[model samples]
Target: MAKISVLSPFLVLFMVLMSSAPVTGQDGSRRQMVPAMFIFGDSLIDNGNNNNIPSFAKANYLPYGIDFNGGPTGRFSNGYTMVDEIAGLLGLPLIPAYNEASVNQVFHGANYASAAAGILDATGRNFVGRIPFNQQIRNFENTLNQIKGNLGAENAATVISRCMFFVGMGSNDYLNNYLMPNYATRFQYNGPQYADLLTQTYSQQLTRLYNLGARKFVIAGLGQMGCIPSILAQSASGGCSKEVNLLVKPFNENVKNMVNNLNANLPGARFIFFDSSRMFQDILQNGRSYGFSVVNRGCCGIGRNRGQITCLPYQMPCPDRNQYVFWDAFHPTAAVNVLMGRIAFSGNPDFVYPVNIKQLAEL
Candidate 1:
């Protein structure tokens, strides 16, 4: 394999030229921003990596992707995911799950995300089986090796560095760890202390990606976890839990800081932090503005608030999925995902700070 130092110049020149040039597709109808997109994190972007796992976090059945053209390809949403929208905006095809990707398919990048996965390995023990952030990075390493084998080391380095990485994680850490009754993380550390621990670990994980030839990154922050239907169902009035929301603030703050530090510290590394909290809050505060009527309840699922239980196989979902913000208990519907993707792709500084996805891809 070619060494990092040997491939640095080619990677740098390639990125510079690609950034300045307008990427076009075969039909020449749209401009392709990035060569490919690589995804990480949890259920929010799992695609289908969890389908073969032993965990109950799978989502490859009916009512899950009814809105999607392929129909339930293991995406938690009804149609597309944030990654899908972002890939579409970049003029690239939908990336395949890492487990199902063939050698040829991997040239477009892979999705190693898994449901119930978190930044910490122990974060999703309740689900029994998951590819944690650490293991996901390892999977990416294997991907890098495969790319090197396919395209030769220099071309592989250039392709990998030029590709975009979208990471949406950390919610499970709060839901499955700090907030779980069986877990002692809450007692072991306060909100701020736990956030600090998560940030420290996250910094290392990102740095590992940087070392593995990833240069462009889109890191999404945690949304209003307390406002999700599942959490709201726990309340008597079905109101969002202020306590839970407050607990997540520290983690988001730390993540933003971590991004800033990475940009300043890592040469050639361009990162964008997507503010999911503000994005979700805007939709919840003004649902009608976004064409959403039910921001609190999920379109699918059972019981009060339609969140006591998740959307099971053969269960009928809402008539109009676009009218609902959330698809199931904890995941957003495809409508909201596409909205978030558009914002991340070209939204102003308000949603994506420092730089948006378009700017990052161009760089």
Candidate 2:
């Protein structure tokens, strides 16, 4: 694996070439890198699917999208998610939430991310009204049917095969389910054992997506969740929790191995694993060089580390939002999101293996 820096000359060249591409569409690009981009994940990538749900996980109010063009759109960040940035890099418009997307919009893509959602159905039961990954996939099938109705079965299959699928689930499974006291998961299995359990379920879900005409996949591993403001607030020393970080290591390892297995066994399918943990580690370790001042607390929210709760409606966030690594207790600010997105777009194999999103699109 090539551990390339963000300033790698090759990455600089790649960006130059991409920016120089011809313009034709309403967007600046001549053509989209892919036919469509389907997103599946939790609040980290959720655009607005949780708005109407009867859940406490919703984020449709102010200070949330203060930096966004359309204002708060249920995105947990001040502006865009990593996927939103990736979508723009792909030369496509931002994908709409599954609930809000029109049939016409489905041709481009739809986001099925729900806040507090997870890979397991029961993972976020405490949230009351989140759509789990399985339900999200069912919703995708509905969208696929619409695609087939409009484009015909054969054409739809061909187009769908070329579409990109961005999946970034499992954070909620750790944060909301397995770690919660109300849930019996911790007692049932130890850390590594629990990770194995989650991975088994995750493997099956990816296979299901593959069976549903998905060919190009970008499976994002869990980030450095233990270092999140929420976990930092929980720590007695007010430092990142090693115990919490260790728990997700096996999960990421298993997913990387799973990506390899899937690519080898699945015919015509190509999958890439995004090493989100490593990427975040780089940011945390070099926050100063990255131009960040606050790496331990959220720009919004109150209490210890400003992480006891997510940001509230109409809450006044910090003035220097870009200097803060966290937007809230659990989410990264747009600054971090965009950095991670672009890195995944063209980072070396150490970050996204065996090829980055741009290379995968070309294939």
Candidate 3:
């Protein structure tokens, strides 16, 4: 997807139409669009999976879920994540985390996201105990077994075959591994080469998912990691890092290319790449138009740019979270999540490649 300094007139109109459209089931009974939706990735999509784990990324505390119903259910944001909105857009209930999955909910889907996780197993080693992409896949496998036991083998296979697999990986590979001074990845591979390594690993990981019964894939591309609050705080001028942004370009491009390849290689499988990078670029450029007043800093946190680890426990967030682009140091606010979810659910090709999530679900 190309970068746009300003949203087009048609896009604005289209967005209005989409937002106004009533979301209902095929029978107008409010049934879910997909049988299930299994989410995978890092903190961006993580709801409560990291809470029990012995990792430093837990968020089931006050000020974290200030906007959420339960008031911080381990989500990194103050309210819903993008996937939460997407779940509603798909007419499905909020998907539960692997740890929170019950027998009945196993038929719906499960979220396996953990903070600091990445495509590479070692990407978030410093975080310790984070569930990497591969481990998340294994978690899904366990859920699949439970599904098979509950729904029977044949019924489970059919149900799983039609389910949506929303994978948003690779962000932490840059933030937690390659960019971290403690890691030796940067010394081993240059930008493009590292991207190739990650993509190759990503391709196989996704293929494993296909073999395990994922057919409808929403592959979320990496966003502008360099523009996050943490990166900004590290810069002398408090600006976005040019080198960090340049490093992940190949990874994003490679993911798009990999999507095309996967579509051709895998039979009965459909894959669409969500251009998260372009979404961030659009938000950065047209934030005011989107009703965002603060974009460069976190709504709540303590430090140079509130880019420290997550916000301090019990810390008071901004009075109005809807006006900020970022909720914490590394995640978007609930409002931004809602916006991205809506657009990706039914936006044009500029944000979602080939076809959007709606079209993919219809397939």
Candidate 4:
């Protein structure tokens, strides 16, 4: 089976959107006229933050960032991920990982995401070297304070206010934390309880951000975790686990409700939800549309569907990566990340929200 890269098609679509007509920013500025971008989430948006942590989730190694920097830069994908696309759209340089000590702080913003981070403070602790969601918030605050100290309070406020904040987390909370037997039993939380916890924690985080002058938010919801090659590989029949899908449904629904409630509570605040459910379903329904020969087989792995624990040179590597939707057991390919960024930063009104990320930055 020949692997076909899907980036050009999606890239063409995005270019068409940008070319057809221009969308004005909230401040009446043209698109790509933003000052900066602030990122917070997991490996999907992490650059090299986890590399310094000495964790299993770190991607600063061979075969990870080989396509871009010719070395692993702590990004889980072969090249830029969704966060980089968002930054590019905003006219800001790609946001550097906070752990990238070599990166100068003069740029737009920094990434505070850890690979296995989640909304809960203690989630993903046992899976990989995980940063708790609370810790991420603390880091953000510390970074903001540092910026304020250097740039002065008014300037810091203005820059932070204009900057767009991107969050790509929550999947690990459910998959790695809640689903784990010991934690689930320890917390005595079933599906609904877990959803409540997620909503509560998310609301708290959003409130904290709001207080910190984060009015415009781009919230990337959980994609089809059940449809990932990892869960599919677990099935002897090579099918997605119905149980996991069932669990994801309530979590997504509660998340939608939480977003709605938060919007109602805070006037003049705009929040958009990107439906990763439909995104993954679209890929599965028409694998050819994405140029994937085997949608269920990961791009990196050995025999069958085993890439989580063993994905290296000795194992098998697909000739073309963009064709596949997933790069490993738990993450999307670089091409898919680009597609997700287009959707996240500038999708149709219904899919995105009151406005896209480019417009939000203008606010």
In candidate 3, stretches whose alpha carbon ends up further than 4 angstroms from where it belongs are 1-14, 17-29
Of the candidates shown, which would achieve the greatest lDDT relative to the real structure?
Answer: 2
lDDT of 3 by residue, 202-225 (tens): 999999999988899999988888
Query: Number of clashes in model 4?
Result: 0
- The TM-scores of all predictions, comma-separated, are 0.92, 0.93, 0.94, 0.87
What clash pairs does model 1 have?
none
Candidate ranking under TM-score, highest first, comes to 3, 2, 1, 4
Model 4 Cα shift for residue 150 (angstroms): 2.5
CA-lDDT, candidates in order = 0.86, 0.89, 0.86, 0.71
Q: 101-134 in candidate 2: lDDT tens per residue?
A: 9999999999999998998899888889999999
For candidate 4, the lDDT comes to 0.71
Leading candidate by TM-score: 3
Model 2 CA deviation exceeding 4 Å by range: 1-27
Worst 10 residues of 1 by lDDT: 1-10
Cα shift from native, residue 299, model 1 (Å) = 0.7
Candidate 1 total steric clashes: 0
- Report the error of model 2 at residue 256, Å: 0.2
Clashing pairs in 4: none
